[model samples]
Structures are given as C-alpha cells and as structure tokens.
Target: MDATKRPLRIPPQFATYAQKHELFELYRRLIARLLMEKPEDPLTFMLEELKREDDDVPAIVIQGPPASGKTTIGKMVSAKLRTAHITPQILLEDDVSPLAAKGRAIIDKNQSIPMELWVQLIQARLKLFDCIKKGWVMEGFPENREQGLALQQVGISPKHFVILDAPDTVLIERQMGKRVDPQTGDVYHTTFDYPSNSEVEKRLVEPPEGCTEAEMTQRLVLYHRHIDGLRRCYHKFTKVINADQPKADVFSQVITALSSKHRSLAPHIPRIVLLGPTGCGKSVQAALLANKYDVISVSSGQLVKEAIANESKTGEAIKPYVNRDMPVPDNLVLKLIEDRLSQIDCVTRGWVLRGFPRTREQAENLDTAGYEPNRVFYLDVPNDSVYERLTLRMTDPVTGIIYHTLYNPPHSNQIKERCQRHPEDSDDAVQKRLAAYNAYVEELSDYYQTGLHINADQDPHTVFEFVESMLVSQLPTNLDRD
Candidate 1:
C-alpha cells in the first residue's frame, strides 16, 4: 500500500494530482524558466519574432535550499502566479531519456539520479514546456551552478530569483520534527500545515519512529555546500527571504518580491502603442484593450474626427485636407494630439496611444513630446479584412462612439437618424486608405524597438484577449487601485 496515499479527501481539482507535487512543479518550472536567456537585443529579437509571430512568455525563478520552507512558499505563491508552476518531480514522471528506464529503477530504489543525466533530463523536458504565453514559475530543481548555467544556455533569463533562507538550526529542527504517516505517507508539520484528525495532529508535535535528527543535519550540510555557488550564479536578480519567520510572513515577502520584479514592470506606468493600418480595428482594439487592462487611450484619427464633429477651429482647419483623404500636416496633428494627451483622462491614467506619429517626422516629434511606449501592438489583419472592416464602419454622430454594423452595432432606434458614415466607407476610399497604409506601415513598424503582430481577422474577443494577454506578459502589475 502507498503510505503517502491519504484517504483524506483532496479537492477534486487536485484529485488527479498530489497537492505537494503540483506545488513543486509550479515553482520549479518558474525558477528554472526565470533564467531563460535572451539574445543581445531582446526587443529587436521580439520585433523579428513579431514578423514571424512567435510565442513569448515571462518566466520567474523561485530558488531556495531544501527544507528552507521553499516548497511551502512555492505552494503559497503558486496560487497568485499567472503562469504554470513547474517542479523537478514532473521530470521523473515524463522521462524520454535513453537512461530513463534505469533512472526509473534507481529513483524507485531511492538512489540519487546522476548529475550528468540529471541535467540532460531537465534540459530535454523543459524544451517541450511552453513559456511563450503565460510564463512559468519554478521551484527546487536547480540547486547548483551547473543546472543554473545549463538553463541559461537553453535561452531563459533569470528575471526573478528568490532564495528562502533559515538558520541552520531551525532548518534541521523543522526537518527533523516532521512526522510522516507510515500508512498514508502524508507529512505533518507541527509549526505549519497539520492534519485535522486528532491522531494525525498528535503525531506532528511528537516526531514518530522514522523521524530522526541526524538525517536533517546531514541534508542541511550538503545543501549549504552548494548553495553559495548557486546563489552567485544568479546574483543579479536574487532576492533573499528569511524563512525562519512564520510561513505567512515569509510568503508575503515572496509575493512582493515577485510582483515588483520580472512579473511585470512594477511602479512603472505601462506605455503602450497600438500602430496598425486604417480599419484594422486599431481604434476599436485600443479602446477595448485600454479598458480591459486599465490604461487610457488616444487616437490621432479619433482626435481629428472628434474635432471635426465638434466643428472646432482645428476641425475646420483640417477639414479641407480630410475631405480629400489627404494626409494632415504633422504640425496640425501633433498640436491636436498634444492637447488631447494633456487632458484629465490621459495625464494620470496611462495611455494606449495611436495616430499621432503618421510619418518619420511625426514619430521623431512624438519623442520630443516625452512619450515613448514600452509595448507596441501591430494589428496584422489581411488587406481584404481591413477593407471589409472599414467599409462596415458606423458612428454615433452625437456621442462620437464608434460602431460597426457587424462588430459593434448600436442598439437604439436613433442609430439610423444619429449615426454618421465614415467618409472612407466606400470601396474606393477603403482601397485608397489601405494603399496609403501599406506605403508607410513598414517604416512606422520599424520605428519602434519591438512590436507584437496580432491576427485581427478573428472575433473581437479573441483579438482583445491576445492583446490584453500580451500586455499582461510585458506589464502584468494590475493597477486596480488609487
């Protein structure tokens, strides 16, 4: 009988997996992947990646010595991570190595897996794991410099490295004090998580027969020997936490550390740019994405159109040029955009900007205005799709809220009376806009450091989700408060 198999009811969500195993894998993968190396220019690489349309995910590394409450911390932290928690034990379960058969036998007999084979196995398995979307968190896999360096060679950056530490005495005592249920193999710690049953609870406080002080001491010694070198390997991003304190306290620090680090640029307002061709849902997506991800939005086209609708002096100023679909002068566009950006909505609230930088000169002037976006999203809708979307455009003449008959149709009976057709809604006008877009799209796309290409031909929700998920990847900190 498996002693570790507790008859105690595990949540059905965890019925297929052991709770401990799930937590270990959660953090092991996170920490391993945090060291995911990148090329010389990651953003430039990302630009090329956008052209090819690849998947890129953020990775976190939770590193610590054994019995330092790292696994417990990993378990607690996994609940908050947006990505997968990957552990070393997952490697043993999904082995394809030539020596996997022998490795299985050795592990079953309780022998340590050899180092050379250990590295190979971990590297191989990680190759298949996906960190291209929601990134991953890792725990308890890399204990030495070899494993750490091997991970970097595999192209992962150690963006966040957290080390859980405790006094040698406390770690040994904690390990030695644990009571293992021989029948169920469940481990109970008197100081932390303990079972509810009286007998099980009693066993935790009083170490059972197999629990010994010696093994704990031996394990601690072995861990300390290699921990220094391991820590040095990832010193750049390492954050140390004292695990001798209460688990909750230690975990709180873990949360703060991970949150502020590579989790997303914390405390830095997300500056995002959504530059795409006309009618590619750039305006629609910018508005949706800004609302969904908690950012403000401004569009050059929207601003000019709004000015025209308001019949402002600037509106009449640009009306002649707009009537002919001719490009508005940069000075006129920049002034309107600058004034709009200074308004209450865009000042404090981070903005998703579009439309101002219509040319090389405008892009340079945008820099002069002290606006630089960290993330750029390119809506790569097919030309035909762009034309189709533009042709269907409708707008509420009163409120200036945009709608599409198929995509964002207005519900009110007044739509027929109140709505206005976009001047470019005609087939020839749509074609002309697309042609103009193609003429300058490459230069504009190349102006930024990196941009993510999105397939906007899909449903609105899918497009928004992809853009939102990408923002979450780059700047995941939720700005949900004052």
Candidate 2:
C-alpha cells in the first residue's frame, strides 16, 4: 500500500487529542516537504522544518483606495500577528536612508513621488533588521504594477497580500464622514466607527481641505485603472476582503489570511475528488483546479464518451448500455475508472476526478483498487440552484463549453447562435436525477465524513477561491523555503 493510503490504527480519544493540537496537519506539512526536498537525512530535515516554522516571519502588504480601511485593518492585523506595522509615511520619515531622504525631498516640494523613488523607499524599510527579523505589515504602497515589479526585482516580496475593497458609493460616504486624531493619527468615521471616548471625540478633527470629495473620487478612478495589473502580479498570494462589512468581520478575514499557513504551490501529487449533484459545477471546478495546478482532469462521463469514440474494448462493452440510456454495471464502470487512474500521467503528475464514486460501494471499490483521493470536496448546492443551472445553461458544440443564460452568456453572437441545450436537461429528467442523488448522497457523505462541504450557490469565482484556499492550506507555506 502507498504510505499515504495506509489506514491509521489509533484509539478514538488519541485521534481526538491529535486533532486538537493539529498534529495531523503538521504531519501533512512534513510529508509535503519531504516529497519536495527528498533529503537523505529525513529526520534532520524534518527537525529543521519544525524549527523554521517557529522562526519564520510574516511580510504582509495591505492596499486599497482612500477610506477602504487599509490602514486600520493593516494595523489591527499587524498587532495581532505581532509584526511591525509600516506605512509610506513611516518609511518616508526615516531620513537616515538616502532613498527616504530623497522621497521626503520630493514630498517637501509638494510634488508626487515617482514610482521609482517610492519603490526604493519601501524596499529600504523592508530590508531593516526589525522588518527582517519580526516581519512587517505595509499599507498604501505599490499602487501600480511597475512599482510592484520593481520591488520584486529588488528581492522584496510580501508573504501575504490583501486588497480591501468596497463600492465607490460606500467609499465616498466613508470618506465624507472620516475623522482623525491629530496627536495619535488614529482614523475614525463619524457614522460607522466613531470614537467612544469623550476625550478622543473632543480631539477629533476632519482631514485637510485638499482631501476633498472630488479629489477622493479622482483617486478612486485612478485606483480602478491600476488595480488590474496589481491583482495579476500578486494573484497567487492575494486575498480580497469586502470592506463594506463591519470592521470586526473585515479584521477577522485579514487575520485569518495573515495567520493561516498556505503552500505557495502544490508540490505533492494531489488526488482531488469533487462531488456534487448534476449541474452543481463539479466538472467546471475540477477543470479549473486541473488547469491551475497542472493536474489531469478526469470525468467519468467524459472518459466513457472518449472510450466509445476510440472504439476500445471497454468502450465496446459499455456502448450498448450507454446507447440504450441504461446504467452500466458497477463492476465494469469501476474497472474502467481503475484502469484510467492507473495510467502513468495520473500516477505521476496527479489528477482531479469529477462525477465518480456516486455510491458508497463505488467509494469502497476505489479504495480497494488503491486509488484513494487525498482531498474530497462536496459542493453543497440546493435543488433549486441545480435546476436553474441545468435548465437555463447552454452548451457550445464546437468548443464543448457550457455557459449559463443569466450568469455566463456567450461573448459573441456567433457562439451564442450555435449553443444548444442537452436533451437530458429537461425538468423531468432533472427531477429524477436529483431524486436518485438524494437517495445515495447521504451514504456517500457518511462514508467520506472527512470531506469538506462547500456552499456552491455563490458566484463561481468565489466558490473557486474557497476551494483553492482549502487546497493550499493543506501544505506548509513556502516563505521559509524561498
């Protein structure tokens, strides 16, 4: 048996104790590192990894337009993580460095600091002893792609990057009611986060006249223009926080992102299984994960179709049942799945399996065949959502792409005209499938109780983010490795 698939033999209480202290998680991290490093001295390597885990520091970057709460959330996260909180002002005030002195000179002349000088100033601050040893959280820097890349070129990179976002209307309203304490530089909002202390309230003052509504609006316009490039640059490590929520919720998300350990990329052979009802986007999410992680995507239905097209022996055996719209025998289907997953590519690079093991028997058969999934996700979409998705979505014959009528219309008329609905997508057929799924889903759920259930009714991108976060969190962060 593959060591990963070996069954654990332990008492229930011992398992509970390990879970409480996250010992299983630590073991997963160590195994991932062992696979990637493949050192001869495995024990010493593991000990070094443990030591580095404790000593590793966090470098975080928080960015947003004015009044988007970057400063407040950045400070809160820094304090919680026990890292230094840094800002552009803090870096500029450190006139000991030549870059800071030059930046201050430009600021003193009432001119905008160029991207080159801004990058130098921030990079210098990040290279300081305290920032290197304890890590630092920086706010309101790298406003454009050029600056972000320049910092990267100079070997300055953040372990975690956050973009706090809100609607323009909400941001404008927040700025309108914004207040600051001149002595403490603490920001407050008149409507949202007013100062509770009477002394602080008495000392609150509005921002300068230059921080006007029109100016803030212009800044927002510029932010939207430059945001796409910045997002692309930091896409892998980035987390977007909805700043329109309450302050505590936003801070909670920030802290979670900062404190959570996530692999920069998968170094293990990921055996992922995505389970959901018909039209719950199991295939879609599986394809996305495959493409993102360079894993093979395996769909049982697609595999059967391809086999039939190729006229293989297994295809010939199963064609009759498929042609007559009959369910293939479980033994034959499991045989086909076992054969496919035993291929060299699936064994080496990894694979994302979709629309398989629909029953408890099939799940058991897979384990017996020595093809166990390391990660299983059950997309929890409602019946109504599945009905809407199937009934209203169209499939492109030429491209084999599926698009929803309301949520994902075709980009051009040419593609839209050729799109067709599957015959089996009728309401009656959907009801029957849903009923069948409901019958066996409980058994499958009971069998794979460790599987993560994802709420799939949200936007597809949001669902993907939630799933990806879980996947990345399995391995240790790559900060120390780098």
Summed backbone clashes in each candidate are: 31, 0
For candidate 1, what is the total of clashing residue pairs? Answer: 31
The 10-residue segment with the lowest total lDDT in model 1: 9-18
Q: Where is model 1 more than 4 Å wrong at Cα? A: 1-266, 308-313, 323-325, 392-423, 474-482
> Which segments of model 2 are wrong by more than 4 Å?
1-56, 259-264, 270-482
State how far residue 391 of model 1 sits from its true place (Å): 3.7
Tens-digit lDDT string for candidate 1 (103-222): 788889989888777666655555554544455677786878887877666764556788888887777667765666655445567656667898766554444332466766666677
lDDT of the candidates, in the order given = 0.69, 0.82
* Per-candidate alpha-carbon RMSD to the true structure: 20.5, 13.3
Cα lDDT tens digits for candidate 2, 171-266: 999988999998888899998899899999999999875267798889899999999999888988898989999999999877767666755332
Index of the highest-lDDT prediction:
2
Task: Give the winner by TM-score.
Answer: 2
